[model samples]
Target chain A: MIAKVARYILFSLWTVALATFAQAADFSGKAAVDTRFFTEPPIFAQQKDGVAYPSVMIQPEFRHDWGSGNNRLTVIPFARYDSLDKHRTHWDVREFSWLHMQKNWDLLVGVGKVFWGTTESRQLVDIINQSDLIEKFSGEEKLGQPMMNLNLPTDYGHFSLFYLPYFRERTFPSSNGRFLFDPPVRNSEGKLDGFSHWQPSFAGRWSKTFGDWDVGVAHFWGVGREPRLVPSFGQGFTHPPTGLVPIYDLIHQTSIDVQGVLGNWIWKAEAITRSGQGDRFAAAVVGFEYTKYGVFGGSKDVGFLLEYLYDGRSSFAPPTPFNNDIFSGIRVVFNDPQNTEFLFTNTVDLNTHATILGFNASRRLGEKWKIELESRFFANISATKNPFAPPKEILTGMRNDDYIQLRVVRHF
Target chain B: MKLKSLICGVLLMAAFPALAQTDEEKGYAIQAEANRRDNGYIDSMHDAVMTLKNAQGEVSTREFVVKTLEVADDGDKEMGIFHSPADVKGTAVLTFSHGTKPDDQWIYLPSLKRVKRVATVNKSGPFVGSEFAFEDISSWELDKYRYRYLRDEEIDGNDCFVVENYPVYEYSGYTKQIEWLDKKMYQPRKIEFYDRKGALLKTLTFSDYNQYLDRYWRAGKLQMDNVQNGKSTELLRKNYRFKNNFSDRDFTENALKNVR
Candidate 1:
């Protein structure tokens, strides 16, 4: 195939070019096998869900320094194999970038991923990359974007500019995957496959730290990473929200993230205002984590997290399970050789009387191995008073994807 | 008038740098001299291997690289990037220590691909699951503690100045610390930390001292033993490169974000 030929040519050239700086180059990466088990059959009868499935991922990173340590190059290539969701099996150039440093300015170019936010429960302001939803249900995994970025550090603030040449589309779960609504909405990848998807976008952020407070203000003008749904009712999907189409639109968004620390408490706040999607709307998340270190004279620390999430549109906004919710969690860290940690979170819906419970536990083995256990539980979902649960909409379908996942990771 | 003038001159002579002073002042002067001797090595970078053992005698190892830059007017800036243990690889911590004030610290989580500012108030807490507290690894400043010259004793075949000091920083976990410094090089050989209840909590031993660049001294190995839990962590340092070109920018949050 032509795609194969192009990939071979590109990789060959990249390798030849890298051979020049091979002496100072470093190689690092991780390999992981993840297995997930569904607690029950998916709520959607139209799905071909598997009770248990496995996935494997390999990520390798290469780095080299040049220009007398003033310039650097980094490349990370990643691939994943899935047993159930074929769409989840994918390859990506996670990072292939060169950075040049100057006295007060820095420049970076190529494909990269950047996260911008100061919240734990949700990352409302982190909009650089589209969500890799099929790989992880948390929506935290992202696809790399091709960009040219510049940064300036000053006495007042650190300013950054980004020019993204292409937009990456968000991946969705396959019908074979466990998580879905009564009927999964189709993701139209061909809608903007041509030059329409290559629209250039620009974004900028200014961040400053004063005393105990770290603040950032950002503006993004581009195709929204978050999708807007449009009604396409004639599809074969039988669910009410099922006929919806995921459409990305050009939008303007401004955001602010603030973090303040005092004693044992860290306070985080992130707010975003956006337009040109459906209607101009705002959303915010504020939280605080108070940690008690050396608990009871032991070598462990326990952190208590409390966060409140808000969506200005309330009932009219997109169906996010977290809207008008209060999140409470506890993090326990064991300062042992195993580097063990555990987190348990409970999200209480203020209006819908629903609860989303999540837990993650991780531990490191001798040297190169890590074991992680994670689970998500959707409980007490009466959805009777849910504003977004109008008739047969998809917002009332959180009970379908409760899963427990286990993973073993090996690093080289 | 002559008697008064003579008395005033004698008092001024007593206040001179080389004149007689109290034990407290002598202790401070000694610390200042040691600090002065260790000053002006612009920056340093080193690879480190940390070995940890539990009460059951099980052992584990971690690898990291530490880069530090010396600051003339304030505390030094240091950064540590973890390389091994799989789960925490690529995780980095940046610290900006202050003389007598609380340090500013941030940790970069590779999985999140984000940097989070951390409160350094819990200086006594373990660092990266290691037995070493953040306070233990921070830069040593002359004015961070109040010292007393306990006595001069022989330790490991070397004459050592045994000093007891209490941390001036309010959030420090130790009530006091007893340190044994070799008289010749003024290098710390051993230190014992006391808990808030004044009970012995742990003992730190430093050995295999290596002199780099002819003027700078670094302990090649440091061991911390916790008496309560019967756990210990041993750090072995190697490949020390000093006076490398490093700027203050190298230790800032910006560097943490950009560091490969």
Candidate 2:
């Protein structure tokens, strides 16, 4: 798969280089080396990654604009090599898109990525691309989605329409990966019933700003990015299931996100209604971030974030730990030359008392170098004997996966 | 008795036009005339190279493009797109200033393709690790400051009218600014900033004036020196383009995400 992507990237780059002799173009990228140190040993024997994972990653970007700057082509390709887990080593084309700008509207074609939502805890309204879980368990990274989007600006607001012709499956950690499930998940046996990956999907969004508030309404109908895991028996087995088989379900989702700024306080909310594999469910996340500037008479800022997450789903729906949870975080900004920042977050499940704590900090070493530290800890996660039962506790699988990562990146 | 004498002086000075104007009124008139001369360019853009030098003599450079849409009744809308310091290559910021009110600002992170609203109360903090504070770089609206005439001074052989400006907005990093406005071009030749403690903090010097559309004058180079820290920043504005006919739509948060 990586060889094929490399070939495609080479071909695209050759074509772009040959056609842009009369215009201006530039190339830039970043390379990073990281090491992850797990605080606990592997719980399952299949987790062969051990307590340490070392990896190297690179992303190079090329951009060319011509015809009075109305047309542009951007290509960004990313690759990573992980020594601990082979499945974690992969390659992806993050963005290979062409943008055409006009007076009243603009159109973008090819593979691209888009993000939406206002809440900090969870992005309920963001469904354009599949999550790259193998890259980061926090689900902040995403794969580029093949799409054609048209954006229109009017007096009322901005409207965007998308025709996504290809669907990308969510990446998952293998059994040998550190953060694996009890029974592990098999991605090769994915079942797509109503549609194939080639089938097209549709999505639209309308966004506007009124005074201090920003609002967006969007709807998506297609193959769901998330898969419902179904237990599957081995070839010779009978009763006990061997592993979980991911089943892609067709879904329809409508969501809205809103954010308002009042002085030093920013209020954010995201709500979504989705239906597909199980009964229709509604989810919401509401939060506020307040910042205190010039802390202690110094050029520093301290911000506090508090959010509430709620999910209304039946027993047959996908298992989730955030059904009823509260998330709180503290952020500090040094406001210095390096733009140093630190953020610590905690999410607590109201019913089970399970908690997930995260810490992330980053600072620039110089003009082209940066260092980042990130860690996640799980606590009070109670394991259930029957993992396949209804209303399973999902957080138990990652109970012993607390890890700290240190990454040093160099940009060119 | 002071009030009676002042009233009599005012009434008598009305017959003599030169004696009728007070220091505050004269300062305001000079600034208003300068502001009127720079009012007609609908929009403008320029590329800037900012070099920052620390007290240890270590230097770093940053490059960005800035565009501004002039508003008649309110503050201007500004957008900045970073180019160099490769890590922040595609990052952009959109700002809508409302003079005395809190400005609306948003920053776009290209890696996540996210546009996040930022708090606007940090006016005293440095901008991008530069000696210039956020308040110093923002659009200079007339209502944002109250003016008082000081004394005349000559900077680089140019006769300049000295004036003191006190920030009208709350939470300012400076107690006051002393500006040496060039008498000929109606542009500032030098500015001295006083910290909140009423001590000298930073000094800004402007040179290389260029006129656009035969009316508006823009500074081609600016250098800010921090007296307390011995740090300084030099900003070189290049490739100035004016009258671009940009509208509010081009400066929106949505536009920031698509900046290349």
Candidate 3:
């Protein structure tokens, strides 16, 4: 079914491009490389088997800016590859889409992937969408990550709508196998069943400024999947399945954000709530940021934030063990864009008492080239045994992890 | 006191136009000579300063470099801007060649800088926050405006011919302008501008006409006052070089970034 849909979308796009070839412009290319390291290796002891691995991702993108009289059409085609240790390599076409803009209206339609995250926090709801096979079952767990996708926008506001279909692979087993009672299930028969298609999702965000205040509201619905949760274990089970049961059939997520600047002080606050899933999860975040000119020889902007997240359900999940979580962090940014180093962030998890520190620096080499460097450290301070163990035993008791990344970019 | 009385009596006698046959012919000859000189000298100016002022009494100044390409033996020609402000300063040249459509042009900003090209049709729009637009600044030959001899007048102590000029451009911003041309130098001493609705808009005053090259008369200072806005622009010329060796190659897109 998914293959048929993908083929139809490709054929339609080709037909449109051929009809407009005489008016189309040339093509361009953009590429980037990103590498991330996990401080605490995956804990394998609790899960019986798991692997703690380092990862590297690379993406190459090509786009065409087509001319159509008073209208403009843009098509971006991209491919990505991720190397997780020596045993696993994940690759796929992440984004493919056509965007048309004319006068005051814009229309976008495609079938590859999508992204739906609008906040700085990684825990609450990142909800990036990709095929289960490409992410190594990471999309089912609700782990926030980048993806190629279809998006549409109009002149009404800075808001966009997106739709992403789901795909399945045979390698990663589903986490919901324990719920099924085995009746001498055979491996070949299980492969013939394939994977079930999850429901599509709808999300909308609207933001506007009133006087000195900037206000925004975001809402999301429908049941897709979240990749952050591990499969539950039972007293008796057979073959591991390839997907998990949807956590919430109808999840309604909403958030309200307000930001204002008073003289030299800047204040921002956001309150978010998720309901209609037979479970209620709420998070409130507020922070005050102050920027002073000519401070300590050079100008510096320092900000501190206090955030609290509460989960009425799933308090014992290995990743989130506390019902109430408190986080605080401070960041200092340099005022100058050229010949300046900026950004220092430190965060602490109050319930588990874990801490994460990060620093980033950037400099311009000349008119076209720029260089950037980033480093981060994560430390676990829990006294309890490793409840959250990865799939392999080699990742058990992961304590401290450090990562450093450097990048250089040139503009045309 | 006696010398002042004698001079006043002679001015009064000169002002009275006696119905004599010789005086009428003399007046007609003077008008013809003035018209001939004004037509030739108005086409030769290569650069000038235009100043504009607004309602709040704020002043703005702009310098224009006009290049003329002679097309006929009589010197009727096409003229355009060699330089301007904004990112369009370099290879962005505006030309007004002889055409049914006032003038045509092509501007090239540095492509390497991601700046795009703009055509000449946009010239009818306003010029960078000033009341004068691109069309107003472009060279329009004397014949482009329908002229009528109003009367003899005195401007800045010089005998002048006041002429009302109606623009022949299909879509000009102004309807008419009244000009006072000095009889001796053929330089415009003052000009009153009217909007498309026939409402008085601005008045430009010229002063300090100095001879640059024996026969050429140039205004050292020019001011444009917006009657509606009460603002004006004052222009002062300095270090103007004429007949300098300049060519079309200097205005090409490839040489934009390399120049200045």
Candidate 4:
């Protein structure tokens, strides 16, 4: 059924392209190369620790405008490789099926990746299936694949639907005979044996602009294949004879966004609620960001944001403790498009006391090429022992990591 | 015969004040005359060039040629021009202007040999490289900006009408402007611009006014200085053809990309 739908979509897009080609002429192309280096050490075990690894990504995009109306065909081919992170080395292609834009209506159908995370605190609905870079670095064969996305606009608001047909499984090795499920067990291949069903997702977003205020509400739902649930002892209740069991069901998520700018102040806030399958566990998060332009000079802009996330249900065993995280960050951007560039961004996690700082400086060498230097710092300052540590020994130490990289990009 | 000659001489003396009165009237009469003169001067102008200077001292000039055609009751108006210097020459058409706020624009690139329409709400935004915006150059008649007589002034030995013009358009980038209009010729001699924050932004001076067709006045040179940026632009008009045999059909979207 999914394949049939994909074929139909491709057919329709081809028809539109042919029709546009018959009426109009258009030419646009852009080529870019981006390279990045990580400062922080690997957060997960079983991954190679790297000090100076470089990655480069190149993407060339092209578009043809058909004069018959506001319709266009766009294709982007991307290639990337990283010596430090081998899993990120891959080739990808994106096709924008048909973009029909009118005065009041906007419709897009395509097979590619779409980013929909609009909030800083609760990035819950950003479920686009991406390659597991961490796993890939460990010599895994799996890679990221394209997904189908559709967006429709209406008078009330917009609606988006996404689907990823293939599902990949993951496993971890532990001390107690390579624990697979909860409580210590022999490691085994996590497979989608009977569940060959494609991962179907849906999101409905509605927004209205009133004067200067924009209010929005969104909801998302997806099927959960593997669910790990641990059993625990409650007040006046004894543990079941059976060991910790796994519970699996579908996941339902909802969120609301409200943003407005008044005078010199910009305010944005988002709240997200998620319900885990089987168990009625929920998580809520809220955040706000403010931006001011031309603070010092006409070329500078500054932004600050504060966010808080409350995990009502913890993933740890037995205790099911609640966790709260607070985050604050500041960003300064210099918008001198002609020459001399400076961009600095710093984000601090107040709860765990973790912070990430980034700095980027670039200068235009000529019309087509530029040289840039960048540095990133990641630090964790939690007082409590590392949660990932074994229960036998108490853990205490701050994790510190930093990286600096330089890149030269030529554009055509 | 002596009594008849004395009566005629008295009538001639009474009518002399109406004919040879001082051009500069003070109190209420001065204000009324200035208003009438300013309106007539503004109504007579059909088109002109607007030049802008940016912070980096870069200069960009745009031509605003307006044509007035007779409509049933109200006059029908149209404007044309190219956006960029590179896009101005042969087989390229990137000129976009509309009569209303939130303008509609079209661009014709010779490379693609096609015209693209741009429909954006913020047409009052700054032009390509200059601080002047499309709203500053488009067909905005004198009636669009409310005027108030500030005081009588003299520019270059010419008595002028110094008036303040406040824009009536919504979301205007300027608060007000002071203009010096030549009293005798009714041509703008100088203008002082104030930003939305009511701070001085720029000053424009017009010179070398030549009478076109004996009845119309056109400025041959214009200079605008950005007070905040310390940059200025000097524009010299050339090859100006007024009331040419151009038709509305020539300015349509289809012809925009093919215009030479």
Give each model a TM-score: 0.91, 0.94, 0.45, 0.56
**Candidate 3 or 1, higher lDDT:** 1
- Cα lDDT tens digits, model 3, A1-412, are 9999999999999988666653454333333344544444332222212222233444433344545332333333334343443212444444454555443334455533332222233324433343343233112222222222222222333454544344332223222111111111122222211234344566666654443455666776654233222333332245343222222234567777665545444555666676643357676656555544334542344555444545454322212332455555555545332334566665565555566566777765433355667666656644323333322211112233355556554333
- TM-score between model 1 and native: 0.91
Itemize residue pairs with steric clashes in candidate 4: A24-A67, A39-A402, A39-A403, B93-B108
Task: Put the candidates in lDDT order, highest first.
Answer: 2, 1, 4, 3
When 2 and 3 are scored with TM-score, the better candidate is: 2
Q: Name model 2 segments beyond 4 Å from true.
A: A1-23, A235-239, A387-391, B1-18
Candidate 1, A210-255: lDDT as tens digits: 8788899999998888765444545343533444456777889999
lDDT of 4 by residue, A1-412 (tens): 9999999999999999678664653323333344444445543353345556666766554555555555656565667665643334656554445555444444545545443333454444344433232322111212233345454444454554555554433233232211112222112322332454465555556654443455667676764423444433232234421223333335676766655545334455555566654445555556655655545644355667666656555443112111465656665655332245566655554444555566767765534566778776655543333233222110111133355667776554
Q: In candidate 1, which residue pairs get closer than 3 Å at backbone N, Cα or C atoms, i.e. clash?
A: none
Best by TM-score: 2
Displacement of the residue B187 alpha carbon in candidate 4, Å: 13
Query: Of the candidates shown, which would achieve the greatest DockQ relative to the real structure?
Result: 1
Q: What class would a CAPRI assessor give candidate 4's docking?
A: incorrect
lDDT string, candidate 2, B111-131, tens digits: 889998887888897788788
**Residues A1-412 of candidate 2: C-alpha lDDT, one tens digit per residue:** 9999999999999988767732566788899999999999776777874677889999988888888889988889999999877778999999999999988999999999999988898867899989898998767799999999999998899999999999888888887887766567788888786788898889999999887899999999998887887778775454556677778878899999999898889999999999986899999999999999878557778999999999997665555678999999999988777879999999999998899999999998889999999999999988757644522667666889999999999999
Task: DockQ for every model, please.
Answer: 0.70, 0.66, 0.02, 0.06
User: Regarding DockQ, does 3 or 4 come out ahead?
Assistant: 4
Candidate 3 chain A, run of 10 with poorest lDDT: A176-185
